[model samples]
Every structure is written in structure tokens, then in C-alpha cells.
Target: MTSQDLLLRILNKLFLGLAAAGIFFGVMGRSRAAERPNIVLILADDLGYGDVSCYGATKVQTPNIDKVAESGLRFLDAHSSSATCTPSRYALLTGEYPWRKKGTGILPGDANLIIKPGSTTLPEMLRKGGYKTGAVGKWHLGLGDGEIDWNTEIKPGPLEIGFDYSFIMPATADRVPCVFVENHRVVDLDAKDPIQVSFKEKVGSDPTGQEHPELLKMRPSHGHDMTIVNGISRIGYMSGGKSARWVDEELAQTLTKQAVGFIEKNKDGPFFLYFATHDIHVPRVPNARFAGKSGMGPRGDVILQFDWTVGEIVKTLRQLKLEDNTILIVTSDNGPVVDDGYQDQAREKLNGHRPAGPLRGGKYSAFEGGTRVPFILSWPGHVKSGVSDALICQIDFLASFAQLTGCRLNQADGPDSLNILPAFVGDSKMGRDYVVEHAFVLALRKGNQKFIEPGKGPKFSKPTATETGIDPDGLFYDLTDDIGETNNLSIQVSEKAKQYQAELEKLRKEGRSRP
Candidate 1:
């Protein structure tokens, strides 16, 4: 054989060998992508930063939550998008600042669906990325249009947004039409006793807390004096659907059942579950099993109940052998509120327990307690056990999860969500340079300095009895020194305040925070 012929044969053989290796690696890469972990986002309602034992609450024991922190990365400076419920949930799912959208505040039970259909939602993005998405628990994000027929199918809710399956409380536990919504229909509705709900006027002859104090099991402290369901006064008026009315004490177990069912059904592969717990919220009635378990009160007992729910979910994951490949996130919608509207003895039975820890304000406030919450990210074997002080917002989940699942989002989707996947997975220390905190007014946190924009509002909210964190002349604070936000530094650090304000305004006008 000629030398030239032998060299050509050698080259041809080498080329074939490389082609075979390329095919092998390509298949392996696809297999790894297919094994992308399941995501479980456990959102607690009205839970404070210090509510969890892991986050430093001495009054209540949260062993299940603490286990999650120990198993993965616990974030110190994480925040929900808003200080209130509806807006915070809106930002969490849509990845847009709630302030950008008007009418995103705490809504009435009969309010219209705030999230428009066909929008790019977190669940929708995940569903499109080959994952089954389910949302169970409190869905205060209003369902249907302004006028919804409770007897009929409720449209444009979790299902319309993106969830493949959903079992949720239509509104809050302290609201009217106190019923669970499975898919688009009220659970166990009766034709003879049809459900009728109204926020504007009294629709039914149901005894209200104001008219009939004799009928109430737990009296309202303020505005939740409209309708009585399960012997508890709610915020709106509702008639009929007695069978569908949810028992307050059974709420925890009911929601837990649905959550566990979702996980079980989808245990074969990647699934995204948004388990929004109503525990520790208004009308704090824990199940009989957990009742009076906490020495604190119903509030503390519900925290224990919430912890049980977490434990149950983790247990299910472990039982199914899905723990290692699951990304579990435990956080609150906002901070804690002892007495929101109901007289649940959360304040009187405080017993020196600090719900917000060392933070100043709670719930409807611009203080650290309002938005700052315990954020834990656990991905067994993938994310290491540690703590991250990096600034993160629940709104970042959409973009971060998108990046994790190899999904590309344009500017229209998750405009404010940054892909802090590195920080999320304990691979990086640096997170966002600054994060926006929303209450009645807007505040910007750049490094340790936080600047609150001047706004005209009540200095203190009478309902929650919380310092609204609002000032007519604006406010500023160095969080590194004053985490409680005791003294205002707007005058002392005038230039720094102005600089943050200017940057905040610029971000507002830009229409998008992430590139």
C-alpha cells in the first residue's frame, strides 16, 4: 500500500472516531438536562423573619423549617416584593415590581383577577419547560372578572395563569365565600344552597359580627366584621354554600392533603409546586392536633402547624425518593402581623415573643420586618449547606428558575428578575447590588444604606398598629447600624439619600431591571 493511501485511511478513521464520541456526549448532556430537579416553593402567609426557629424565634419551635435551613442555603437578606399580600404574590409570580401595577394591594374577596390571562407567569414558564406545575393553598390573587358567579365555574384563576392543577382558598381565610376552589369550581357546592358573595353590599341574611356578636366563635378586632362562616367573622358577605364552607381548624390539613397529592402524582419527573400556606394568617385556628401546642397562642400554634406542613412535604419527597433532585424554597409572602383585623389573641398572648425579631415594624411597613423574610433554598447534593447574606427578592425566582431549566426569557418576561442562580446555589457570595422594598411608599436599599421616598400617608397604620414607615419629608437609614430603623438619617445623609432616590427613579423609568 502507498504511504499517501495509508495517511488518508488514518485521517478517515480518526474523523469517524471523533464523530462517535460527539454523539455519546450529546446524549449524556440531554439525559442530564432531562433530570433537571423538581421545584417546590413553600410560601408562608404573614410569617415574620424571626417566626421560624432557624431565623431566631425563641417562642416557637420550627424544627421542620430548621431542617430545611440545615440541609441547604439560608438567606439572611431576602425579601418579598411588597409588604402586603396581594402585591407580594403578584411580584413573586410575574417577576415585576408590584408598584408598577396599580390595584395590586390587599384585595376584597370578590375582587377581579389582577393577573391577566395569557401573561408570562412563573408557572407558565415552568410548564412550558417540560415540568408539570401545580399551585395549592391560599390564592388571594383574585379569580374571574369583577362579577363572578360563585355557583358556576370560576375562570381566569390559577389554571388560566399557568398551573396545570390547583386547589386553593379563593381569597383569604378571613374572607367571605369561605370555600376551597379545586380547579375552577368551589368544592362541594350545593344547588339548593347556592353561594353568593359580595364585597360592596350585604347580599345575604347571614349574621355579621357587627349585628350578631352571640354567633361569633372569634370576634373581629376591626374591619373583618362582615360575614360569619364556621362561627368566625370574615371580611366580606356570603350566603349559602354551607357544605362548601371550609372549617377553619381543618384548613391546614386540607391544604396539606392537596399539596401532598400533587407531589405524589408528579413524582416520576420534574414538577413545580407553589404551596402557598394560609397558616399563621388571620383567624389563626390551627387543627385540633396542633391546637394549644405552642405556649404562645393560636398564632404560635399555627406556626407549628405550618412547620408540620413543611415536614409532611419533605417526608413525601423522601418517601418518593425525590428529595435529592428537588429544589425546596421556604419563605413568607411578607412579614408578620400580630393583630391584622381579627382578635385572635396574637397580641394579648404575646408573652414577650418577638415575631419580627429585632426588626422595627411588621406587615404593612417599609421597615426591614415588613419585606425581609426567612428565605431557604435547598437542593440536596447540588446546593451545599450554608447561609447567604446576598440580597434576594421572591420576584427573582422567575428568572432564576428559568435560567436553571435552560429557558431563555426576553425582556417582557421577568423584567425585574435577575438570574442569581449562582448565589441561589451557594456558588457565589454576591447577589443583587440593590433591592427595592415596597410598602405604602417605595424604599431603595443600596448596600447598607436604605432611602425611603417622601410620601404623604399616615405615620402609623391603625389597623395593624404598625409604624407605616412613611414620612412626609422622606426617611433614610443605615441598616448596618440601625436594622430597626429607629433614627432617620435623611437630613444627616442628604446627598446619599438623593443619590439613591435618583437611581430609584431611573430604574422606574427604565421599564426593566434586568438585561
Candidate 2:
């Protein structure tokens, strides 16, 4: 037979196999068997590429996180849009780059809702497809208008932004208010004392870490010396709501319990749970149960606790028989930061363990460590278990999920999100050709080549103690060859660097990365 006839026969057989598989799974129909899968997006706070055992952290054992990787599709090239929690969370939810919108930075606890009303969100898209959506833990996206009364019902918040039920931390654990917000009210708050929160000025007569360092269990390394709550000082000032204040150690347990409860209550049908954990962030106070578990101090202990949280959710899913039908994603908001603020012995007890692994820079950096995080997507009996180098981002969840559930969205809805559902489910090996990383500076990554534009800023942020990746001269590195970014190939490959710079400019000017 001729080569043309052989190619035609091979294509015919491939089509037949796909048709058979589609018929068996009802992939071409919207039948009950084809019901939209339940989604559980577990966002870990400050989890780095090397934080999980599966990702090569020898000091920390993350057996549960490894389970997800063992049974799911793990992506080596997955990244968050930015290197900070607030900005990355905004980009993930809004499907727009945080830099495009003003006020999308590290927010004070009292800051207003940065996500505007009527904005289409990931939860909103899922809700449109008849899925009940719930958000629990670490909602640092701000709440209410600019001047919100903590005593009153905080409206125009998560509920208005597509979450059917929300129990969130309002902000970071290190930030104040330092209480859980269930639905629209503060959980266990008393009306007699009322809750008062302030970032600029002192709220009440509560003793601060600055005034009484002896009272603090964990001393602030930098600016986390405001109001004392549960023996730990936070970034902002809070006076009343004693009953509502969350114990620093109990945070992981509380958030995990909330997530399990949300899953149990919404187990009747399709549901979406955004379980954002504050574990491994600053004030690394792990529960007594997890103390000394890692022998690497609070930082490592909290990582173990975070793993436990993942185990609990997975256990719940298995008990309810939701594992097969549930789509669980385990990923981080950004890279790691050892000594963010508190004196937690994260740096001292590191014992030569690299949190960012082979990647240079962490947290607030334009390098791979800042945004490239461990991403795992698991749906038992549906998605094949394997490792993929496909370049995927948390921002693509909005558009990819919309297509997965048959929910239609216009380009206006998710200007930066792309429908890479095939890659997500392990059906395709290829994903986006390039993606942008935002930090103090902007950088573009196309395949193995990375180009960082020139920007003016202090090369190092003294507070976070991170390299800001800012320089007057543009930077370029072939990440495939030099993962540490030690070599400057911009001068050697001037033409390629210029091309990437132009691509970055065009992407910025167009205001959207997806076509």
C-alpha cells in the first residue's frame, strides 16, 4: 500500500476508537451519566514547587499531597498569575491579570472588595452550569465597600460574587480582624462588645507586641507587631470580638473542618468548593498534633498540617463515594517564603532544604519559583494518571471549566482564560505556547525561553527578604538550560530577547493573553 493509504487507515482507526469511547462515556450527550463533575479546588497558601514530597522536598513529608500526584495528572509547568496571595487570588478568580486592575496588591484587612460587583468569577461560571459553589478559608480578596462596618452584615461580598456559601478568613491569618466570616456574619461574634478593626490606627486598648513583647509567643521579625490575638501579634489592630478570634494553631483544623462540612452538606449533586488554606504562610503556628512532626520548626510542622488537611478532604470524598465523580485540584497561590514576618525558625531549621527547589527566588519574584507551583488534577476513573509538562495556569480554570461543563462565556468574561480542558484531563500533551508572570516586574515565558523586562525597584525587598527580580537592563535565560537563572543570555541571544520583549508588549497592549 502507498503511504497516503496507510495514513488514511490510521486516521480512520483513531476516529473509530474515539467514537466508541465517547459513546460509552456519553461524552457527546448531556445525560445524567454525563452530569457535570463536582469540583474541589484546594488552594494552598505559600506552597512552593519543592514544598510537597512528590515535588522533591526531603525535609517535609507530604504523603497526602503525594497521593493526589500518584493518582492524578501533575503538571510541572503550572503557575499562578503572580507571586503574591492577593494578586494571584484575584487573577485566579477574575480571570484577568491583577496588574491590569488597580488596588490588586497586598491588601489590609479593612480594604474594600477589590473584585467589582457583576464581575464573572470561576464560581459564577460553575454556578451558571447548575453547580452549587462554596468558598472556605483565606479570602484575602477584601470584603464590603471601602468603609465596611464589621458589626453589620457585610454585603456585596463573596455571596454577591458567586459563592453560594462562604466561610472565609476575611484576610490572611497574620492580618487582623483575625476571625472567620461565615456567610455574611462573624462566626461566634458577640453583639455586646462588637468587633473593631483598623490597619492605620490602633483600635482598642489591647496591648500590642511593640508595647509588650513578653506577651507574644512568636515575636515579629518585621512589621507583624500590631494587635495581640491568641498570643500572636498580627499586622492590623483589632479590639473586640474576643469570641470570634481564631486561635493561630487551630486555623488549619478549623478551615479543614469547614471544608469537610461544606462537602458533606453539598454532596447531593454537583458542587464547587474553593478550600484555600492559610497553612505554610507566616505565623507558622501548627496545631499541637502536628508539633515536632517535621522537626523543621513551625514552618515544616504547618506543612505537615496542610498535608493533613488534604488527607481529610480526600477521606471525606472517599467516604461519600465522591472521589470518582469529583475533580480535585491541589495547587498553590504562589511560591514559598520561609521568614515572611514572624520569627518562626523557618530559616534556622531549614537544614539545607530548598523550598523553591531548583528554581531561584521565591514569593515576590519574577523567576520560576515565585509563580511556578505544583498543580495536580485528579478525577478517578476519568482522567489518566501521569505527569505533564504542559504550561497551565490557575487563571485558565475559568474558561477551561466553562467548556468542561458546557457553560458559555464570552471573551469579555475571561479575557485571559483559555479552554485547555483537554490538557487538564490528560487528553492532550500541549497547552499554552506562552504565559506571563507578574511580580514587581513583568516577564514572559515561551517554551524554554524566558524574558524579563527592565524595571526600576530595589533589587531586594527587605521585608520579605526576597529578590524583586528588577534591573535596568533586560534579562533573558533559557530555563531549560539554566533553571537557576544564573546565566544572562540576553546579550548572547539579543534578537530572541527582543522578540520576546515585543511579544510581551503586544500581549500587554492587547490586554489579553488568550486568543
Candidate 3:
């Protein structure tokens, strides 16, 4: 009963303690592995590269969005896959190039949905991985099938493409049928006032923008004038859905409230929110409260609205105390352009504000500013605050989030999305080897060198503006040497151009997202 008995007893106790520890940690390990971060993707519509304070917009202040950048990683070199609205949104949601889907350019509000139903999408992937998904604000990805009947429920819209809930604009704010479509139905549509839409001939008497310039509050400098809505000429024709029409000034508040409500409701469960904003876009009708705040007209006023909306979201996160468990990705659909279609004097009253920061080209061009825009990420305890030059794309979110949740996207779907969790964590310095840049045709970006193809330049129409690289030559420039993309290096570096050309072809052949 002396030393031998005491030693045996001590050894037995130690073995039992070790067994319990193993079981406890094993369960904890599985739980951590199953732990998924709440994902928030805030997409600013038609916002220029330099529109936000983080991106260097001196004309306006966006302190709230800047706070997200300060709290996390600010990506300086982020490029949207396409230069236009529809294509870029499509590419971002599906992880595929816009050109892959024919007839899928900048869609008219009247046109039937472009995205095929029952396909794999970003929000859909998250839903499959045990996440509640919703998209609040603009949905330019098209809706319904061929010959959609307005009186009936709309099909194959955002909800059909993987969103569990959606409240979005059918197309652009400047377009007709200017109503909010929630889930499968257009909101507030009275049965008596059936909606009818057409991109071509007018269906009823609504005073065409061309005929009734007297009623116009916002006149178009280009092709925007068509139908009159809320005293503004739009791009298409719509006769009904009168009650469903959205108030342009109140759009920011509506979207912000919806986003905040969703976050508060889902605090207990991991959720994914695709917050798409209609600020700084064409038909820049900021609320009366935010009017003249930027001293730049409706364009600048809308920027203020956007900033305040962002502040509300950040405040909601702090209030919920879910900052550490959430991963917020803030990026725009494409670069900025002042005129777009409206004559807001964005070009004249521009003052010293640089909407594209140091990049060149804007919105619908193959140049740097056209595709490259501001990108920032925030995850309180998980991500440290700093600026990163790591080249990333909107397409990569599919693979990144999928990797985080132990979900895998079939190569047929997310072909171009590379899982950059390490890069997101700020440990790795590499992203994609080469990313294809699209304005209309195609361009190639590899490392610091960018190669643009010649002919049929992106701006086929005047609405694209002159800033859109229409020079009758292939554009090439080293970003390190020319951040504004002023100098063309097509002749100076012929070999580098050829290499990028090959890269572009390879990626194109492999193809992009489907749906």
C-alpha cells in the first residue's frame, strides 16, 4: 500500500484525464471547423474607382466606408471582370465572364431575364452551405423567361439564381418599369394597373422624353431619353406598376434599412447579405436631406447618401457585437463615370475631385479605371488593418467563401475563382496568375503589365463616353509605370504583350461561370 500503490493510482488518474481532454478538444475541433463566418458583400453600382474616401475621392467624403477599410484590409488593385453594369454584376455573382452568355450586355429593364434559371450562383452556393442569403437593392441580372407576362409572377430572377430573398430594381434606376421587384412579384402593383414594358416602341401615352423636354427634371446628354418617370426621362417605356415605382431619393434609406434589419434578424445564425447600392449611379437623385451636401449636384449628393448608408451598416454590426464573426467585403461593380447618361454637370462641376483616383479609363472602357475599383475587407479579430496591393477580382469570392465553409464549387461553375483565404488573412502575397479584363472584347492583366487588344474598341456607342479607350489601337501599359494608363506600351514591349495575349486566350478557352 506504500509507493507502488500510490504510483499506480497516480498513473490511472493521469490516463483518465488525458482521455477526457482528447474527447473535449475533438468535439471543439469539429465545431470550429463547422464555424462559418457571416458574409456581407456590399456592391456599389456604377461607383467610380476614386468615389470613396479610401480610394481617394477628394470631391466627397465617405467616412463610414473608409472606416471599414481602416478596420480591415484595403485592396488597392481590385478589378471588376467587366466594364459595364450588367456584365460586371453577372460575372461577380456567377464567377464567370459576361461574354460567355450571348445577348447579355447592358440589359434594358424591359428585356426578359438573361440569367438562365436553376444554375449555380454565389448566393446559391452559400445557401447550400447552411447560410441564409439575401440581396437588397439593384438586380441587373435580368428576370423571367422569354415573353414574360407582367400580370404573372416573375420567374428566374435573383431568387431563382440562388438568393433566398431579394428586393431589387429590375434593371437600372434610369430605366422604366422603375419599380421594386420583391421575390417573384413587382411590389405594390395594383391588379387594375397591369404593367407593360418595352425597349422598342411605346405601349401607351406617358409623354416621351424626346417629345416632352418641358417635363424633364434631369435631361440626358446622350441616349437616356425615352420614357418620362417622376419628371425624369428614362431609357425604356412602361405604362403601369405605378404604385410599385421607387422613389429615387429614398433608395439609399430603403436599402440601408433592409440590410440593417436582415443583419439584426440573423444575428443568431450565419447569413450572407448581398447589399447592392444604387448610389452615385445615373439619375443621381439623392434625398432632399443629403442634397447639396457634397456641393457637386446630385452625383455628389448621392455619394453622401452612400456614405451614410455604409455608416448605418457598420453601426448595426457594432451594436450586434458580431464584428469578429463577420467577414465584410466592400467593392464596386466597376469604375466611375460622371455623365453616364444624365447631364448632371459631373464633368463640368467636377472641381478637383478625382473619381478614378490614379487609374485611367472609367466605367465602359478597357483602361485601368474602367475595371479597377476600390476593394476593402473587415473582420474585427480575424483581419488586421493595413493596405494590400494584392490583385484580386470580384469573381474570386465564390472560391474564397466556398473554401471557408468546406464547400467546393464545380470547375464548370466557378472556373476563374481562386481561393485566396491566405491572402485574405494577409499572410500570402499571391492571388491569381492572370485575370481577363473585359470592356466588350477582352484584355489581359498579369502581374504589373496590362495588354489590350486592338479593334472594335469597347465603346461602340456614344453613351460610353470618350474616356472609354476608343483609340484605334491595342492598349498596353505597365501599371507600375503608368497608373493613369496615359502612355501606350504596345510598341515598346511587344514580347510582354504576346505573353499576356496567350494568357487571355487560355483563360477564355477554359471559360467562366454558367447561369
TM-score of 2: 0.95
Candidate 2 wrongly placed segments (more than 4 Å): 1-16, 19-33
User: Which residue runs of candidate 3 sit more than 4 Å off their true CA positions?
Assistant: 1-33, 457-464, 470-472, 512-515
What's every prediction's RMSD, in angstroms?
A: 5.4, 4.4, 5.4
Residues 145-169 of candidate 3 have per-residue lDDT tens digits of 7876767788878877788888888
* Model 1: lDDT of residue 250: 91
lDDT of 2 by residue, 417-489 (tens): 8877777887778788788999998999888889999889888888767887888888999988799899988
- Candidate 1 lDDT over residue span 319-421, tens digit each: 9999999999999999999988777788888888899988988899998889999899999987789999998889988987776787668778888988776
Candidate 1's displacement at residue 373, Å, is 0.2
Which 10-residue window of candidate 1 scores lowest in summed lDDT? 23-32
* TM-score of each candidate structure, all chains considered together: 0.93, 0.95, 0.91
| TM match of model 1 to true structure | 0.93
Best by TM-score: 2
